[model samples]
Target: MKMIKTSMLTSVIFSFLWVSGGTALAEEPNLEAESAILVDAETGKIIYDDEIDVILPPASMTKIMTEYLVNEAVKSGKIAWDDEVKISDTVRELSLETNLSNVPLRQDETYTVKELYEAMAIYSANGATIALAEHVAGSEGEFVKLMNEKAKEIGMENYKFVNSTGLNNKSMDGQHPKGTKADEENMMSARATATLAYHLLKEYPETLETTSIRAKTFKEGTEDYIDMQNWNWMLPGSVFAYEGVDGLKTGYTDMAGNAFTGTAERDGMRFISVVMRTDSREARFKETAKLLDYGFDTFTYEKVIEKGESVKGKKALPVSKGKEDAVTVAAGHTLSVLVEKDQKEKMTPVVTLNKKYFNEDGELIAPLKKGQAVGLITIENDKDDEYLQEEMRENVKVPLVIQEDVEKAGWFSLSLRSIGGFFGEMWSGAASFVKELF
Candidate 1:
């Protein structure tokens, strides 16, 4: 998995680029929000951001991690979507603990796993989340451990979990306290939340089905049905305008005001954006729109190299003692780039062919075996030198592999080839020595 460095567009250059699209670069909007980030979901590339790593409360966006663990369990067959779940006393107990968001439930009310999942994803229901926590791990404390473990698995190093729900140590009496409570606040960086959300989308697509639902009704043997509407207002109304805006989650608190983690796919390009602690709900939407607009308009997603396509301009490598003359070499995976529209003309893929095979002459050969090491191709743009040096440089190299198998020659053929190679090496050395002597 090659991490390609992307060219960064400066504000000055970005202004010029926006004119090409006919939209006067809007005043660099004031995003006084506490934390913000935008990422290309497919490539896990940070397209835009501000204070991304500063620790902050995630609010309901914490549910993304909860959804991640549950979805993973489902995919691994440890949990079934239709499996029945009983609302244990712990679930009811937690519901009492948090009243801001919940699907009111009575003791002994039973619901299916899928229904609870929907409530948690669509409504950010605290009760449903606690219910899931208890069902999956027998206790919220154990579930918090799993949450931290999953975070470590995904390289979210700066994050720690004290609870599955994103509740930091708010004084039970509204009094300011010190010590771990100061840092013990359950929190995730803007970057971490976005990264976790990106991983969830890649690994468990079913979350989208639940997260995107506008509203759902749950009837768990209760007299009244609890209908919950999705908090992400970008679905159709109540927020910033963008086509194809599906879902994600929304979060809010006195400390973290009107936060939102959102995703929308347009023209096959999916973007994940997060804004935390905005002054109001509208600001969150407007800032997210600005960030997303910058991402979609400034850069175009392109498939630079298709998987299994032979690396252009690379010659067949020599394979030593192989039956075949040469091996076909190609990229093992697709190489895609998100670059400024203007820079596309100057982009080129630089290929580094690996010497993985040999010919009868004791020289390197190609037409290598399937999955055999071939080389790497680095895609680069002439523009944005700073970005090229920083973010895009690491992703420059991608694995090149043999496109197909190269069979070794028969025993007699091998014997003959081996002898020929020995003479070839000897003659080459003698010729080199003679040239030096002359």
Candidate 2:
């Protein structure tokens, strides 16, 4: 392994402008939502945040988790999109509740998984979400367990789900499942909500097909055919439509207020924005647009290293006892960093070898295998004078691995190499002593 640091010029003009109050260094949009977050969908980098850590009721947004689990079950072959789902008494009762968002599921009728999914995604139907959950897990209680487990798996640390439909049990008018408390509702932070969206899109990108729909007819050509319209106004053709806004989920309740998790893509860059507890329905979409625009306008993804590419100055690593004297090394994977658009050219890379891989003599041990991680290559922007500080710098790290295998040398070869290494050390020490005398 080797260490290499590249120096680059900083954006002095921008720094001067910021210091002189010409413009703030980090200019963020003022959002009206109680809590909101915007994250890079591919990299999970936070572009803008306000009260993102505060936990609040997520309302219909809880369906996102239900949607995720249903997709997971379908992908894992536990269920199929065309599989028929029997509506239960509970689901039928939920559909009859005029106060809840539903598609009027019939107890005697059955629908395909895809139809139910469309209802949940497009209309935020509470009954449809519950039906899908019950079909996948056999019971809403069991499905709620799966939702919490999946949330933890997706890095949602501040989420709690009492029901799959995101409805407050009090609103159920005593029809809620047994053991569900009246005050129970899903609660999650804006940051966790954004994290969930990131994982959902990364794992199951096909969900965009459903979330992007502006309007569709479920169970078409049948007596039960119902017109479903997307609740997310940020989609194309909506009153507040924004270009590139395709997905995700929208939520509202008297208690939870209006909330939405929106995703959009432009020029190969995709972002997820979550707005929770906004004063009105339009505020959520408006604030989300501000977040998305801020991200795309300010930052861009920069590829720092390509997979299978060797780190500069790290062509080969010394081997103590092997078939050959040294073995080549290279980066194990591609590394990219999200930086301010103006700071792209100012980004620098620093590579450092892990000290454990080397001996006291600074030689790599023998018997190294290909793809073994021996060091790390970090990429950072030099625009900030405080680049050394981890908190203030935007950087990414990729593993540096041995590119080829180095087999152990025979006893005879090892002895010969040891002798040569001993003399080399002695000669280096003698030369240093002579230099000091001079």
Candidate 1 has its poorest 10 consecutive residues by lDDT at 171-180
- How many pairs of residues in model 1 come into backbone collision? 26
Q: Give one digit per residue, the lDDT tens place, for model 2 in 1-438.
A: 122222212356667777885644457899899998887776676777788889999998988899899999999999999999999888888887767678888866779999999999999888888889889999888898898889876657788988988888788777565556777778998887887887789889999999999999977887877888899998899998999999999999888999999999998989889999988998888888898889888888887778888867777888876888888888788877777776656566667889998988767898898999998877644333321123323336778899888888999988888899899999999999999999
Clash number for each model = 26, 0
lDDT of 2: 0.83
Candidate 2: minimum summed lDDT over ten consecutive residues — where?
A: 1-10
TM-score of 2: 0.86
lDDT of 2 at 63: 88
lDDT of 1 by residue, 198-285 (tens): 7888888667877777777777446747778787777765455467677788887666568889998889988989898998877777
Error of 1 at 271 (Å): 0.7
Which candidate wins on lDDT?
A: 2
Candidate RMSDs in order: 7.6, 7.9
